[model samples]
Target: MGDGRANNPNSHSNNSSSNKPEWLEQYDVIGKIGEGTYGLVFLAKVKSNRSKPIAIKKFKQSKDGDGVSPTAIREIMLLREISHENVVKLANVHINHADMSLYLAFDYAEHDLYEIIRHHRDKVNQAINPYTVKSLLWQLLNGLNYLHSNWIVHRDLKPSNILVMGDGEEQGVVKIADFGLARIYQAPLKPLSENGVVVTIWYRAPELLLGAKHYTSAVDMWAVGCIFAELLTLKPLFQGQEVKGTPNPFQLDQLDKIFKVLGHPTQEKWPMLVNLPHWQSDLQHIQGHKYETAGLHSVVHLSHKNPAYELLSQMLEYDPRKRLTAAQALEHDYFRMEPLPGCNALVPPQPGEKVVNYPTRPVDTSTDIVGTISLQPSQPVSSGNSVSGGNPGRNGWRNKSWQHSDAARCCTASSSTAADKKERIRNGDDWIPSTTEIEALLSFLI
Candidate 1:
């Protein structure tokens, strides 16, 4: 079923039906854009409206032969509850009951920070514009603030996960994608250490490395801080080698890398430092080494006087409590300065600087999604499992998009009764829980 014109952008809409997966009839899948631990992602245009481009993410059924993976259900439920301008918008859902495969549709973003940073580093051999950096960070923090306010914690935040919209009315808009590791965190609950892995190694928070049983939104802040520094320097702030194993081994190397630049964590500086799960067991060897020679300002080339430096320091703080929250970071002096952050991250405020035309995300159309993953039989999808992924604007989510997106979007998720919801899913005859349906994911949390 692979297309001969795999690289031809014009051939994306051709739905030569022979051998095409019956489930994929609704979309003219252009090509596979990306794949990761979760599933494969395809670039497709709506068959009914070829002009509307969207990304279709396909996930294999759980190993237990259940309909949707628990993680995926959690992701979808969280997404349905999420409605923000800086958050990726879910468009539709496709469920292949034959193989228990689930497909989610989202607005196609042309650029992500990972590609943008790589382009600046490898292709252009230059630093990202300061105005552009500030704008991106501001939008990122703003979106994060909305998530935190809604009790959602995006544990896996990195350059690749932060997507920037392509040319459109929302061009230059920052959209935070990938909620695979996110969960609703209400205080006084069980420890979050159950899941083991969280943020990426390079962007991981210090407390997580030290083994904090109960972390908070501060973890996300640390990742944003790392991303902020990367934008300035075009390199990872702490490029640590992750140790792969079960039960999530203590990342000694990662902590050592962080300690080298930020110095050792003293009891007085971080009072709760001693109470961490791995404080005594993992940090004994590196306890006495005082790493003062390579401070953050010098590492990232930021002066101590600059507000950006201050913000970065707070984000990398060893103590989670000391770390800045998304709301507080957004109000910092860095964003209040001249050439302030604008609505469009691509359009800079500088008079002389020209707009940066970011490279489009690559697509490989040679492979087809029909036989991508081995098929398995599973039980029928449960009610409230299917998602149609409604438009955020139509749900009246735009006005308060910046506030609690999860809470607002979840309200609609709960507006329908169980019987009605079940009836709707039955009528659709597909298990598609599309959009940021945050509530569907709540059962997996806590």
Candidate 2:
């Protein structure tokens, strides 16, 4: 809690600043749970009923010191219209008339996929029980099915964004939080204009990496595939580095890593692949080397005969058109196999399976609720595992807060440019052999 981190979340104190808004007076501002570029999330309990906990997200004002943040407005507008058990519910929305700062409150989720996975991998040092895995994935897809059915695409689906309830009636229920990047696909996509980057690099779909000007809901399904792989193997399936820059930077390393496992995309498999902007313009760098899709089973340590593998293969299909929708995924044989998925993800579905007691999310009880938090980011971590003492994964998940991860950073830094490090890798605008490329190629082959 000393450095705005949640090392000890159980420590509690009612540390609200005197400047706290009048509306916030109804709830006891317990502490800060998370801080991201958009705002700070505080943990609070209703004064009338302390049993009911709430997550209060206070949006930061724009650099121009203007009115409410547009992202906040978008989240409010979309969430207010949709209602689902799997989706995070927006309980209240309040605005400060003086500063015009905005606040959105929702139910506090105790754990997220990122934290749960890390606990199993690091603390418990065991694979998550297959029954628990099935249950978690089932609920995730069930929730996603509801969203897709309603025509919404969660562009930024990842482990961290999928939150799980801690206790009380909704315990173990999965709630897909953070709707900032969510979009109703009933409207046509506006390409990079909407967000410099859509999905986070690691979980991003092939069509997106290939720079498809127009994409579909299939993108979210692709991320679901990535999350499923992580759940199965306890590590990311594709690890790619994002070149930090303004405008756009071709993600050569990520594609190479994906290709190494899934193989190169051929015209026969994905007929429309050739028409994508990056696939056309960056073909020379991409197609020059061919890859074979033979390592998935071995890497995941699952037999080709396994039902889980069959479902995973479908989800990770190279062609977005061929990928399984969340609805279709829910009907997969994997979920119907022995030890069928259960409603509660945290508990073992069957009697013999191990029950994992996950650590609860921490709250910073010392931070003043209305006090200023540092907006300047420290040097970014290469991946989310740095604090947890794990490897820097492929895709480089830099930030650790609720919405401060790599995908969301693209929104705030849309106008900012990376250092001129590209000069070192370019030979008069031509990409040539370098240590970075060699390492990326080595990673690809592995």
Prediction-by-prediction clash tally: 14, 3
> Which digits, one per residue and each the tens of the lDDT, describe model 1 over residues 408-440?
667766676666878878898766776575766
Predicted model with the maximum lDDT: 1
Every candidate's lDDT: 0.81, 0.78
Measured with C-alpha atoms, the lDDT of residue 198 in candidate 1 is: 85
For candidate 2, list the clashing residue pairs, or say none. Answer: 9-363, 239-394, 240-395
**What is the Cα-based lDDT of residue 7 in candidate 2?**
19
Q: Local error of candidate 1 at 442, Å?
A: 21
Error of 1 at 272 (Å): 0.2
Q: Candidate 2: where are CA atoms >4 Å away?
A: 1-19, 189-194, 373-446
